[model samples]
Target: MIHRLFRHIDAGTTSYTDETGANPVSSYTCADRLDRERRTLFRDTPLLVGFSGRVAKAGDYVVEEIDGRSILITRDREGAVHAFHNVCSHRAAPVAQGSGNARRFVCPYHAWTYGLDGTLQSIPDGRSFDGVCKSAHGLSEIPSAEKHGLIFIRPGGGDPIDVDRHLAGLERDMAAYGFDRFHHYRSLTIERQMNWKLCPETFMEGYHLQYLHRESVGPIFFSNLMAFDSFGPHTRLTLPRRRIMELRDRPEEDWRLIPETAIIYNFFPNVTMVVQAGHVEMWRSYPSGDATDRCKVQVSVFTPEAVETEKARKYYEKNIDLAIRTVDGEDFPLSEAIQSGHAARAHETLIYGRNEPALTHFHASLNGALGA
Candidate 1:
């Protein structure tokens, strides 16, 4: 079934096409293109990176990986959000390991210190260079912006694009998910042996829900699925039936009250979000490099009541754990096997069934962007 609902593009048209007939694989999936997209999307433009749920306050911080670059996102004393290259300027050490609260980041290597605002506070050798320019050598500041409870960052020291412009239709639908009202309950990371594209592509449609996820998640969703709408490179797919709670013998009344059982938001290039009834989870996949075709998938879970109560917190945590086991334990291993099979000298072009419209759309977008 076709669920086509087009939203008018209000912003001035931005061209996204390749001149050459030769379609270049996504710069996101391509190793050589990492520097380009990183510069353009993360460094030059304010791309959404985090949510303003639990960590929206001053001194709250999280470590994120965007386009293969590790980033440390922090809110300053004044509650202003900022981002920096998570790598220490001194000795190239990783400034922060995982997510936590920090007033200052001290590099585990050589003990170089930096303020929460990305200012280089002190170096071990204060006397070594008497007049060394410290102001010019602070931690590289990545442009960042906060909107609708989401934190965005531009990684490549470039100019930033308007966040609202990028989030046009997404904002409306996401608001319906109560994204702004939700709090961050849990976050998890999964290392997959497959290409980054494989991860998002896996959730692009519900065609595989009945076949691949039958035991774990299949029995809960509808057989006939619909995907509607595309803005720029982003797309959203809506699942009609209440498959998730079906296993629990949930009543139709409960289903009717729920906004959507499944809503998958594909943010062009690498990120994808799965909006469920109770929580919203986002996955950012980064290709390890160009040649290997291996990628890392980072999953962040957000709920509307993480900081509210202990029971709410546990509920979110349990939900996150179930999701991780299903995706990482089941989906990822299969994807990895597929990638390896595709890479074999004996294989040719991979095939996509007609029912897999999401995957088809993804490939079409990839081809268009890369000039394939």
Candidate 2:
């Protein structure tokens, strides 16, 4: 963004990092430490689940799984967004199945119904219970908020989730994109045998871009040289294209932040966003369950414009395919292989290079969140 660029120019540097190096090993491989992070850092924190376009209409709703919690987020007729535990009030069965336009969510177990506002509407057999208070039970509400065209919820099923406070000023810069106006294109949810934290680290640095993605997006981006900034626990990493220098002579009003650079917002703990000219890709990783060794990623791509033509659709389809190959094919395979070493009782500590400051900041934030 121009704002960020100006700040970088003012500082006379893209970013800063202490040249002193440190080794962090237990945080990555220790099962107990991983569990602590899952409980304190990932679960208690508000997570970016989906974009606003997902539930754009009054009745549009989406079902998401966050850290093993089934979250049901919906937009009421009043154009207000609400979130609740996906389980039915009775027998704890899932109230909503997948995501679609629905006035009410019916439990497949016994037909217990709930309104879009999360109110208990009816029961199949009202007389089945002697003393039942229908009004006393509704879908358990969770903290949720819709802002800047994105949806966030706290999976801990607590009171109102203060999503704004969590951003810590990153919201102002993030709102510039007007993500709420974007269109959700396609998504892929895949299960993998890898630590949840390692998956996101793969996207935080350009050190690997040249080596791991050299055959794919590497050539298109200026690898190794990147601009970084830290906001609370969040990180802004800019991988400027070789053409970014063209903006130096152009008028400020005529400059465009996207296409000329690959800006990545690493929303600590789980969400990572890649903002480009045509679209934005959000990758959210959730711990599969109590198993720290397993994780799942929900990859959703949003386009500022509709893919109305067959060629456009094919381009996106091919884009997603290539992204999968670059990550699943090249990056994740290496992550899994690296994770295997954690159990071999070989390396005790892994070093964080000065060049990979974003990675270092991320791990430090994660550690601080876990009260390490």
Candidate 3:
């Protein structure tokens, strides 16, 4: 990471683009396009649903709503993670409600019971069914896996996903951070008035940091000086902190990645994995109820080790608070204004500057995924 930083510095420039510009307004803003995206892109592709630490033990489970699909994720006694459609085979009512440790999930509507592994265990009445196969009527399993401490699930119309391949070999690189060993500390979910893409897009670049975050995070980090590395549809954006210049006096061998540079990994579709000084922050955005104009952002923080003291806890608390204020207080309000502009058709087409190559690659890749 430091090598790349110095490379950009030596070249007297950060990453760049040719004169071939891109239209920012060229997005899936219409209802039809959003429907198609939900059906084809999100449904058929693998999605990072939760951090593995969320269900760190046997009998632990969590119910997540992803793109209109209610999903039940569980870790069984044997320590295997399973994902299933939360719907009961009996009356289609959800077998699981929220999150907790459960030997088995029982449908709240009736008495239909399901094992943690998603098998139908019992039905209150056996005679009520006519030619029903209990084994065949278990909860429908979604293509999912717990890889590198992250749970991935495909909701509908998709083939099984090879998580390693899907990550474009990032699993090996991410091992250095020990994401699987990290403990989830906190999470916050909020509804936004902008499109889901806007949330991740806002994080893909630091070009706006000097301006948008000038008072908050801007002074601490460089603006528009970023290095982009693509791993298939996923990308890693390395933005150095102002303190990174301190490494100049030290030997190149003493250079370290963490604490020096803030690495932002864009896990394609929605997840933004931010490597902070000592912990990790994951921000996930989901399209709301098939609407293109609205989305939900579920942000979480994970630590390599638990914050054992009030001072440590307060430090993390302040960091997260700063992030919340910067994004929700500053960035999101701008997103709302941009959404209003788009709604009013303010510009025939918005343009991405040559400096914003990450946005260019993202939208282009999105268009490819949508088969535009």
Best by lDDT: 3
Ranking by lDDT: 3, 2, 1
Give one digit per residue, the lDDT tens place, for model 2 in 251-303: 88888878688888888778889887767888888877777678899888898
Q: Which runs of model 2 end up more than 4 angstroms from their true locations?
A: 1-16, 248-252
Q: Write the per-residue lDDT of candidate 1 for residues 244-300, one digit (tens) a residue.
A: 434236654454423535778887767788877777888877766444467777778
Which residue pairs come into collision in candidate 2? 149-180
Which parts of model 1 have CA positions greater than 4 angstroms off? 1-47, 123-125, 175-178, 242-260, 307-310, 345-347
Give the 10-residue window scoring lowest on summed lDDT in candidate 1.
1-10
- TM-score, each model? 0.80, 0.93, 0.95
Q: Give candidate 3's TM-score.
A: 0.95
The C-alpha stretches of model 3 lying farther than 4 A from their native spots are 10-12, 24-28
